[model samples]
Target: MRTQSHLRIGDQPWVKWSLITLALTLVFLLLLVPLIAIFVQAFSGGVSSYWQNLTDRYTLHAIGLTLFVAALTVPINLVFGVFLAWLVTRFEFPGRKLLITLIDIPFAVSPVVAGLLYLLLYGANGWIGSRLMDQDVQLMFAWPGILMVTVFVTCPFVARELIPLMQQQGREEEEAGVTLGASGWQLFRRVTLPNIQWALLYGVVLTNARAVGEFGAVSVVSGNIRGETNTLPLHVELLYQDYNTVGAFTSASLLAGIALLTLFVKSFVEWRQARQRAALSEDEA
Candidate 1:
């Protein structure tokens, strides 16, 4: 009996078109519509109104606070992630697997729960907070607490990106560098950094996106104090609560703009990574 060769599922034209149509419909309804609506409503009162809302003192403060959090969050996580990734991928020790598992705690735990955990540990009545408070230091209900939760939530991104790539690349190149008398810093800067830079940048982009847009944990820890502890996301909520539709959407549009910028950067990094892979393939060939 004869059989068809090169057969594949969903090869029919009708099935292909149906899938495409369904995906586009979902995209339009779920993503595009909301994104468009944000801009539409933001400028509904005209450009001057939108600009006024954006330049409002509270709005400006929120924007500044959000950027401050992201700026701090990215670098701290970047260093920590690189260190953790290197330790796990390059060494064998007790609790190595457990350490790797613990890296995922941020992802596994709910953001709100994570915020509460911080609050419990660092609130005025709590063990650590009671001592810190004696010295007139406060963490919870302030910027420090916001930064802590943001860092906790975004910590996994860079390491997650690097770990698999590092494992696959292995220590051969690094070992060779060491044998040739390269120092640890030199070896990482020259050998490992070049190979994993794209993944590192991709991870940074994701971390920044999450850090900038973080709301739930930040809201809980920040005390939602307008023009002070409030970040952009919290400010948007405040605007909406105050029945300032234009202001709310204006703040939201800035966030949406940030998300778009992140998507663009992520796509660029992926494209660059793809090109690098192709070049390496050609060299091998």
Candidate 2:
């Protein structure tokens, strides 16, 4: 006989306002304030000083090396991710689940541990490393080592992003295309690619971000040889340790800019994906 209940958790006016206020405060303190502080410290010495710090030879080298690592990491992971996702989702093979689980190893393992493992296996003293050294090859404490660790750390992003999307998108259309005499490449290029383009782009953006910002693993392997092997994050740490506060912040600002740009692209990709879903829903109706 009682009227239907309309109350919900946090529906009270004061509770709602208080929660909103708390979230805004936390965001300001944790995120916005730090970003603002970075810019402020970066330009504290004036624009000319900031520009000079950024244009220093080491800084430029760090920027170039970071970009180079990301450039190589993205394409390698992209192809591997697509192939892995396609294999697991499209085929019923033995050990598929185990393979998927293994893909998450990077996420579960510490970056420092990963770097150390690579160093042990590929450094000059370990079994493989000793053999490589016999052949006059070196990987640890160099750019190659940096590239290897960065790749290891970022390899799972694209695959993780694509697996769920491809799973939801069943292979019916692909099978239909095959029945219609479509070649494998034709089905993938015409059907699979279009369906997962947004997810793929989103994954690429994430991979690029991580590749650029990685510090722990890269540090363990890079040897921090200033202009030779130092990346932007390592450069920032070196500057701060050497008491070059302004220079440190200047290097940091570049990383902040990259992060902001990545965020913007990620949001845009998400919006496009949502709109695509809406359009698809309308068509089905």
Candidate 3:
């Protein structure tokens, strides 16, 4: 029995690992069940019919418009997220707390309300909308208006990702650069940019995902015009309404595929960044 106990101890496989495996298995089942169902439906239309339906003019137009909007909105959000993160992190201000709270408002606000707020601010009969209309500026229910609402709802992502890191690092590196006679641009380009680039990229990926998949807010402001303001998510809704469940699920599956691709890309990027940081640290030592 003592020899048997010793053998068991020596060859112990592991228990925690089993728990982890079980956890992952459960998670995968939870996600994969619905996804596999959708995939089954998407292809059940047969490869030819699936391709033909997916390539239909309206479907093509919807995909193109959504991609165009995401392309436009993602970059804007990236820049804004980075700049806002830098300002809030690097500077001290009286209303800094208030500013941070305000940035988080979008995260908590119901997306529909966010949509309505934009409408009220930019609609023809609304306050700011009325003034802008008077000045011959158009907004509400326009493409530009749709993108604006998307940005507002997705604004907090990058800033939230960055602030804690900045707080932890403080201003030591940047201050050191300044003390070494580094110019403002040099300090930012050399010191700041390198530090936060990963978080920025990750935020961009997430923000792009959010913007592309956005429904409630975009639905309200977009007017859901086909071949015009109809983004992919809205298009899915339109197809679903027409009793085109296959088409709708096809589009949803496409979005899900994009989301999965983005996540893998983000993970790869973060992995590379981590490896590079590790290499640099090793070299410095």
Best by TM-score: 2
Name every residue pair that clashes in candidate 2. Answer: none
Candidate 2, superposed: residue stretches over 4 Å from native: 1-6, 283-285
TM-score for predicted model 1 compared with the true structure: 0.95
lDDT (Cα atoms) of all candidates against the true structure: 0.95, 0.93, 0.84
* RMSD, every candidate, angstroms: 2.0, 1.8, 4.0
Candidate 1 structure lDDT:
0.95
Q: How many backbone clashes does candidate 3 have?
A: 0
Q: lDDT ranking from best to worst? A: 1, 2, 3
* For model 2, the run of ten residues with the poorest summed lDDT: 1-10
Span of 10 residues, lowest total lDDT, candidate 1: 1-10
Shift in Å, residue 54, candidate 3: 1.9
Better of 2 and 3 by lDDT: 2
Best by lDDT: 1
